[model samples]
Target: MEKQFVLMDVDRNVYEVDRVLNAQTTNIRSFGSEWSIRLQRLHGGLSDGVDVVWVDNGCTRLAILPTRGMGIWKANVAGVPLEWHSPVQRPVHPTFVDQSRRGGIGWLDGFNELICRCGLGWHGAPGTDVTRDADGNVVSEQFLPLHGRIANLPAHSVTVEISDDGAISIVGVVDEAGMFGGHLRLTAQLTTYVGSNTFEIRDTVQNLSAGSAEAEMLYHCNIGRPFVGEGAKLHIAAAEVAPRDSRAAEGISDWPTYTGPVQGYAEQVYFVRPLTADDGRALAVLAAPEGDRAVAVRFDTSTLPWFAQWKNTQAEADGYVTGLEPCSSFPNLRSFERQQNRVVQLDPMGSVTFEFAVTVVSAADDVSRLVQEVADLQQAERMTVHDQPNPEWSP
Candidate 1:
C-alpha cells in the first residue's frame, strides 16, 4: 500500500496524496515538517528584471527583492496584509531611469513596502552643493539624490540559508560607494522560524573609507488601508513629539488618530523620541479600532533613537498611507543635521548595527495586552519638549 502524505505551499494551502506517486511526477523534496525558501524570478507584470526570494513559514509569507537592495516588497500573516504598497503596479529595474532625475521620489514610484532604506549621505533634499571629485578637482552644483542610492543599488553577494530545525535567513551585501564620495556598505539579513508570526531584520552599515564619513539611515515602514484607515490608531510610548514642519503642526493635536481621506490633504510628519523599555527597546503598534488584528514594530532604541510618523490621507484614488520610521536621527537635509550635530558619523573602518522585528498580533487577548503595554509606557515619566519653538502669527 502506498503511504499517504500531505504537502503545503507558501500560502499554507495543503494537499494530500500518495507519496510515491506524487514524488514520481513532481519535484517534491521533504523538508521534514520545516519551512521553505524558494529563489525565483518574478515575471510578466511582477518583473522588470528582478529576482525574488520567497519565504513562508506556515504563519507568514514574505517576498524579498534582491535587485531592489533586498527590500521586502510584500508580506502577509495568515492572509492578512502586513505592509503598504504604492500604485506603481509593477517592479522596475534600478537603472531604468535617466540619470538626471533619479532620487528617492523616483524610486518611491515603483515600490513602497514595509521598509525603504534611506541614506548614506542625505535623506532629504538641501539643494546643490560644492564637492571635490575623485581627482581632487572641485566640482560645483552637485546634488545628492533624495534619499541616496543605496536602495536602488543591487546586492553584490546574496545568500539564503535554511536549517533542518525550520529556521531560514537571507543575507545580502550592497555597496553604495564612489571614487570620491563616502564608501558605505550595507549588510542586511532577515530571519524567520517555522510557524512563527514574527520576523527579524538585522542590518550593519559600515564606512569602508580611510576618512570619517557622515551617514543617515531611516527604515520607512509603511502601513496602509484595512490595517490603517478610519478608526485605526497608532500607539507609541514617546517621551517627546515634534512636528516635522509647519504643515504637520496644523494637525498636531490629532497625531495618533486616523481619519478618512481628505481632498488635497497634504502629508504630516511627527518626530517621536520613544521612552525605551527595560530591555532598551521601543514598541509601537497600529491597530484596527474594532478588531483583534494589529501590527507591531519593536526596535532597539540604542541604535535607532528617533521615530517619525508620516500620515498621508489624500484622496483614495491617489493613496492613503502611513509611514512608521525608525532612524538614527530625524529626516532632514544632511547639512541641517550636521548643523544640529545630529548626523551619524562612522570612523574609518567603523560599523554600526541595527535590529528590529515586525510581529503580527491576531488574538483578542494579545491585542488587549499590547494596548495595556502602550498605556503603561505613556504613563512612565518623560521629558517634554515644546512642540513648536518659533511661532509666527498668520492672518
Candidate 2:
C-alpha cells in the first residue's frame, strides 16, 4: 500500500499523506471548508478510493474524485470492489456533466454532486443531463453549483476534527437568528482507510427556523456499475415502501399502486419495523452478489427511527446498487402524505438525531441473522403520521 491519501489537521490547518500509492492513485489534493485531504486509490484485486468532507460551498462540495464525469473503476469501503465482467460492461471512469441551473432541488445537500455528477431538479423543476466523451465514457467539466437564500441568516459556524485513526468529525450550522436561534444544522463524522476496508459515516440535522419549514435530505451514495447490477439483492427489514407518485425517474411508485403484496423492484421508499437487534440497536441490510459483498446499516432506535431505500432503475446511471438510507428525513418531504405516508416533525428549537453502525461482509447470506437480531431487540414503535397517508408507505 502506498501513501496515496492525505488528511488535514484542522488544528494546524494542513493536509498530510499517510500512505504511499502504488497502482491506485496519482498526486491529488483538494480543499473543502478549511480541511485539505489527500485522495488515494487501492491497487491489486478490489477497486477503492478515499474521499473526504462535505460542505455546501461550490469548490468544497465538488472536489471529490467521483465528481463530474470521472468514474471509479472499482471502489469499495469493504476492500471488495464489485467485479464487472461478462458479455456486458467493464469498469469505467467517472461520468459527470453540468446542467447550469439555479437552486438545486434534487441535489440532496450537494452530496449528489460529489459522485452522481448530476444536479438536483429543484432550481427549475429538477432534472439531470449526462454528457459522455467520444469513447462513450462520462466526463465532468466544471462544478455544478446550487445555492439558495436563507430566511434568517444564522451565524456561519463550522468545525472539523479528525481522530488519530482518520475518523473525521464535523459540526456545521446554517444559523438563523444570529446563530443563537434555532437553525438548520448538519453533523457528520467519518473515517476511511485503505488498509481497513470499513468506512463509517454518521450524520444528524436540526431545524431552528420559524413556522413549519419543510425539510429535505438524502443519504445519496453514488454507486458504480456491473458490480451493483441485477445480481445484487436489496435486503432490508423495512416493512413497507413508498415512491414519488409522479416523477420521470424510475422508482417503485411508478407501478400505479403500492397497496398489498408488492414484488419486484419498483421506485419506492421503505418503512421499516422499529428495528433493534438483541442489544437494542436499529439494523438494516444490503447484500450484493455471490462473488461480491454486502453492506449493513445499524443505529440506535431513538435518534433515527426511519429508513429509506432508493435504487436507480436506469442501468445507464452511475451504478446498480440500491441506496440504503437510515435518516430522520427524506428528500421528498412535500410528498410525504401521498408517497412516504408519514411525516417527521421538528418543533421550534427542537432537534432529532440518528446513530448507526455499518459493516461489510463477504456474502449476502448474513442478512437473515442480522435482521433477526434487529427484530429480537423489541416491538414496533409508533411513528408520527403527517398530512396525507398512503397505505403502501404507511408505517
Per-model root-mean-square deviation over C-alphas: 7.5, 13.3
Model 2 poorest ten-residue lDDT run: 115-124
TM-score of each candidate? 0.84, 0.51
Model 2, residue 187: displacement in angstroms? Answer: 2.7
Best by TM-score: 1
The CA root-mean-square deviation of candidate 1, after full C-alpha superposition on the true structure, stands at 7.5
| Candidate 1 residue-wise lDDT, 363-390, digit = tens | 7788778878988977886646445522
- Give me the displacement of residue 285 in model 2, in angstroms: 1.7
lDDT of 2: 0.37
lDDT of 2 by residue, 1-395 (tens): 22223233344554433332222233322222222333333333212222323321111121222211221223343334433222213221112212233444322222232122111111112323233467967553323233111211211333444444433333333332234323455443443432443444554446666743333333434333423544555544443444433331243433211122123434444434444555646666554444345556666655455555555444343223444555444333223221343334666555655455556566545555654554454345433322233444432
lDDT of 1 at 103: 46
Model 1 residue 47 distance off true place after TM-score fit, in angstroms: 3.3
- Name the best candidate (by lDDT): 1
